[model samples]
Target: MSPRPSDRRSFLKTSVATAAAVSVPYIFTSQDARADEQKSSESNDRPLVGCIGTGSRWNAVGPNAMQLGDVVAVCDVDANHANGAKKKVTDIQSKKGVQRDVDVYEDYQKILDRNDIEIVTIVTTDHWHSKIAIEAMKAGKDVYCEKPLTLTIDEGKKICQVAKETGRVFQVGTQQRSEMGLKFLQAIALIQAGRIGDVQHVAVAIGGSPTSNSIPVVDVPSGLNWEKWLGQAPLVDYRWAKEGKQTKTRCHYEFRWWYEYSGGKLTDWGAHHVDIAQWGIGQNGDGQGASSIEPIYAKHPVEFKDGMPLQDDRYNCATNFHVKATFDNGVVMDIKDSHQDELGFNNGIMFTGTKGRFLVNRGKIVGAPIDELKDNPLPENAIAEVYGGKDPARSNAHMANFFECVKTRKLPISDVFTHHRALTTCHLSNIAIRLNRSLKWDPKSEQILGDDQANAMQSREARKGYEVTV
Candidate 1:
């Protein structure tokens, strides 16, 4: 039998030292001695990896994880997805002139049980992120989990706690932090150097949450494990349409539109853009967040009570919302959907301060402060400082950094604590919209002050047998 939660936690604490000392290194053979030497010069130590959630989003991260280490196994609730990912990984390895066979599994616990696997990349659904992450940490594997890290504030907190207690190197997949030549880092560096001149406001545009009319339940896809996919979430009928038509709202990409599984764009893109905004505004740490969140304006497809959508068939996340959050430092943040006249990028973050403002997205960073950088550039080591002394020029640097930390035993730039804090802001915005009212927050205590119902929304009771054990 798999170890119990308490046993796993205790094992993690006791076994970490031994595990690190004797961890296996994945070695790849080369066709020639010269080629072998070249590969050896690249890195002698490559950790064994197991990827969970081999779906659409996993396609990107799953491959990237391979670039950092050897993937020995793959897991997914969908049999087709799991098999497809296995083939992809095998093909990639074959192209690299390496002969490797990857085992496929439907249960993530099977991957965690292997003493050979040292790292786990979690690309599962929002609701499964926290449970799998905490369990993986207890299983003594360093983790690289995709963001928005958890389904709710309570989940995020548990993930953070378990990570801390396990002393595992954890990296959240908010790749924007390590992507695009570290543009977000540059923006934050400018802000910290007083370039933004005592910033007063930050505008983050993550697009609108999804909205859909009531969807009809349909048959479950042939190879999908509907029950396991809905782990920790209320068991509902599997919904999908025939091959061509838009079927039920519970499959693949459509899952993001529902409140039961996700927080819509609020957590979908909000996890990315809002995370950057909080980092830029210096509210990206535990006990550092908005002091008050006011729902300036909001609208949803279905009516909600006690911060939950009343209907399960339709997309319930707010489709259109504009919330104003004031931090303890008296900085105001406007998080909203794109508008015709708003001064921000469509799916990016914009920082507004007293002196000047700048906007950054995947494509570019622009505005007056950025323009000024033409004459006065950031310090040469700015990005290095941001990345905790790791070289930012490495290919797929984010995953590379995680691999490095897996060896060095250091925290990655995108750690869980700060991520949870930023996600709290996004969660707060959604809660305010669900209630269509303003709410006060005590950042230090991480509570919705004077609002019991609102505070209660910070967590949800998981379905039996799937509860996330911290």
Candidate 2:
């Protein structure tokens, strides 16, 4: 199950070899930031802020952003969501029993146009993230965007380029890197410390998406702007139907179950667990990631023709999948939709290596290797090193780290660069499954090797009006 008794030299070789090679470069400089906004944000304890896409996730991200900064505006295509967010932010910021009115907008541009706003929290649907985030950075606003950060591999590239170009302190809301009681960080620390000893394989179990019945076409809700909500993707009729009392729609929280909008659980939970897996193995770097992605198995709820789903009325994303991502360094990562409960993992990551193996999730970190930590404790700085050389305790809350970085101008805990590399692997997995084949990848150039058809899936053209602007 594990490696032979190895000498100190070989153990050090396995652990320290990759340590210096993959240190994260977390800081970048921003250009053309307005003097007044910068002065107001940096000099003041709380920054002036805005919130976009205040549907389900905003109940969490909105308050987190508002707690760190004063929310002056909120925007959403849905009037109900926008008005709801207005009350949420005002209630959080208002003193004592008194509350204030927050500005609400159907168009996100108004918030971006404000010279007074210093930061914006983007919790929009997957397709809207890149466009609004890029434009916000150009307008001199720092951003805290939710995860599954890109709709396609090309979107990830554009986001990284603009983040570097604008020098914005952009943070992707992958809280596992900061929160979850630091179990993920501990797992990474153990891997980097040779406790797992040159990890040969990583198994990530994020459960599958659920299949849905054909949701009948219905009139778009009165307050919701159906056209704007479908920005970037091809416009489709509003679909909503009740199944035994539960509402299934083509938008909002259920959007992840549709390939046109998101990548199902591969990106949903993969954004958290896979991000950590790559971070542990030191693959969360430029030009040093998965060399190939192969789909072992995949099953979707609807039929497919040339990778596009045939039915528009049902959830179309893959319901079950087993994808393998191979690294040039001989580490193979297997990402599956789910795992057996009797196998000791339902939703978590299991890292197996030559020396030992351990399992980790939000709840706990356990295995024979973890038990060995008692007599042979890890180096004191192990977790700190995995956490970009900062005290791990400092970033206990993800939003706290984001706001702290907003003032210090340091990189947020979950910066855009590493996230892009991790997300690229997830995107490649979905592409391989959709095409029902394996893929050769060139990490340095960020391309699909030897496959023209597969390469085209890396980017998608937006509808005429919603294209991302440089």
Model 2: per-residue Cα lDDT over 1-470, one tens digit each: 11223422343444343334223211111234345445655666677888888999989998777666777678888778887787777667776332334667777888899777889999999878999999999999999999989999999999999988988899999999988888998898888778878889899999999888988766566567666788898766667888886778888888999988999999999999999999888898888789999999999999887677877778998889999999999999999987654664669999989998889999989999899989998899887787777675743378988887888889887999999999999999999999999999999999999999999999887888889868
Model 2: what TM-score? 0.89
Full-model lDDT for every candidate: 0.80, 0.83
Clashing pairs in 1: 241-247
- Per-model C-alpha RMSD: 9.1, 14.2
lDDT of 1 by residue, 89-164 (tens): 9999778875556778778888899776789999988888999999999999999998889889888888878988
Off by over 4 Å in 1: 1-44, 242-248, 339-345
lDDT of 1 at 287: 79
- Give the clash total for candidate 2: 2
